[model samples]
Target: MQPSLAELQRALAARILAEEGSDLDDWICVPSEADSAARVAVYVQGYPARIREALRETFPAVAQILGDGSFAAFADRYAKDVPADLQNLNLVGAALPAYLESDRVSGDLPFLPALAELEWAVDRCFHAELLPPFAASACSGWSLDEWARARVGFQPGLALVCAPWPLRELRETYRCERSEIDVDLVDRHDQVLVYRRGFDVVVESIEAAEAEAVASLQCGDALGEVAAKLAGSGAEPAAVAGYFGRWASLGLVVSCEACPLP
Candidate 1:
């Protein structure tokens, strides 16, 4: 009996992704004169090649760091291990950072996963929806007590990434200057703020405290709780206030809502 369409599709997909144990001839048909295995191999080879190009587009800095040859190999391995589950090619590399962190590829380049994460964040920020900034006038009417209960909402594109390597600087160096990566620079921790302003995606280095505060806000914490937590963690009130002002000016905060009265 002939296999169903779904079964044939499943078998072809498995073969294309280089999964083991799929007999190509069992699912594919070719003329007696034509090579069935060779035809299947063509699709198998093209799958990773297309995915590699997409990954290269998404992670130009990482591609430059790893170079063409190495990046191609890495992309091939990643595609095989984690097949593209999304219909959109733009999101194909969504699992790449995790793949890099897995035992399959993490041994040689410990920093690659973090670097991939930064790149992915930048890509996401560029495509994320834009919303109007929270009206500054709304804050003027709030009493100190009312302000404490307010929760801040961020723009859709905002992403904070904390990594042991200086991912932001490395990304800039590779992207802007096309310079060689410095191995010594990966020794320290760094936090990056990624967001879109107008048509450009901006990547800025931020202090650890600021990253934490933004993370808290992103998690729906109220201003009062975030402030108290920051104070407990050794951040001065003035510093926190200043950071909030900066964030507001940058249009990172898109909405503010007061907590319900108890």
Candidate 2:
């Protein structure tokens, strides 16, 4: 009896990825004159090659830091350890940030996980669909009372990364084609906002107070509640307006809703 399509696919995957080339050939393509095992070897090499290319594309900064040979080694190890079940290569590096954190692949580079996280976020934001920008004029008619209870929504793929290292600077260090890297590994608290601007994904460092309000809004808190929290934290709650204005200008905001009454 012939193996089903699903069975053949599973066998092929195991043969290529796990090298579990047992009776896989028995269920594969109808025995042709050509060497079928050679065909399988093509996939065996191609799968890892494709995944490595995708990782390089998604994490160029990481590749630059790790160097070609080292990065390829790490990429291969990651691909092998973590199954790439998805057909889309773009999504393959989605878990790389977490993997870096869990694997602790580099002891010298303590910031690798955070850097990978920022790069992954940039990749995600670039691919994310941008919705219609929120209109600040929509709140023109609302009274102060109504404005306080308004719940804000940010654009899709907006990501916040707070780290003890200057992640943006580190990423920029490798962003350009430089022959040599003069890295200043300064340890300081850095908060950055990642979002799509037109077709480009941009990363900008933000203030601590602004970061607080953004974090609150991201948590689904009302603007009034965020303001109160900010005030309690000794931050100027009114500064939220400036932050909102900047976000609106950058097209980060997508929606705003008022608290519903029973």
Candidate 3:
């Protein structure tokens, strides 16, 4: 009449994740003086604590902006709302940015969602693999037509986050290692690029045209299509070329695929 090991595991999981009454108490043993409910409570409390700690580490700026008390409260609510990804605490904060978009905290600080997004991007880039520097000489023989027809690939660590807020300044102000300073939170379109350069992650503001071009490329658009879109947006003829030039110099570019003209 005893529950199987698999059944005990299922019940224990339900107990930890939520307030689901389970007969797991009947399975786990403890000191005669201690209770099974106390053992279950340890896991119930520890799991959320571990998740909050991971989120704080990954989103130090957000945590600083929210302050210790508010961040803790929001993290607990998030733990309840969003199921942990792959049961890994390290990946728990992956949903924080989207979760903040609708949370009450965002109502007070309108930039919270974008800021969290940038932080997440930073974390991802730091963890991404560093690819070998791409050789630009590979395209020396390509004509303009060939270049336009090509689909460009970028480094694995590249990520673009666009927001209508001065995101870079805000991120630096509360960044983990910095003194508090006044930062103007002017509402303006900010296109931020995050990529791993050498051994460190670089987070910098980029021009709108560049962000647009990179975004198109990230979407798998051909270089000519990206150029046409940029032209429609009033970007100069040389603007698309400039983007590629800069990207190549920075090692952001990885490869280019162009078919020979018939």
Tell me the RMSD of model 1 versus the true structure.
2.4
Where does candidate 3 clash, by residue pair?
none
Model 3, 77-162: lDDT tens digits are 99889987586677888889999999999998899999999999998898888777678888899888898888888889899999
RMSD of 3: 2.3
What C-alpha lDDT do the candidate models reach, one value each? 0.83, 0.85, 0.86
Candidate 1, residues 57-165, lDDT tens digits: the string is 9988788877788889988888777756689888999998888888445577677889889999999999999899988898888887787888988999899989898
Candidate 3: where is the Cα deviation over 4 Å?
35-38, 176-182, 259-262
Candidate 3, lDDT over the whole model: 0.86
- Per-residue lDDT value at 195 in model 3: 90
Q: Give the poorly placed runs of model 2, Cα more than 4 Å off.
A: 1-8, 24-39, 176-179
Q: Tens-digit lDDT track for model 2 on 163-203?
A: 88888887886766645766677766788899988898889
The candidate scoring highest on lDDT is 3
Quick one: ranking by TM-score, best first? 3, 1, 2
Candidate 1: where are CA atoms >4 Å away? 21-23, 26-37, 176-179
Q: Is 1 or 3 the stronger prediction by TM-score?
A: 3
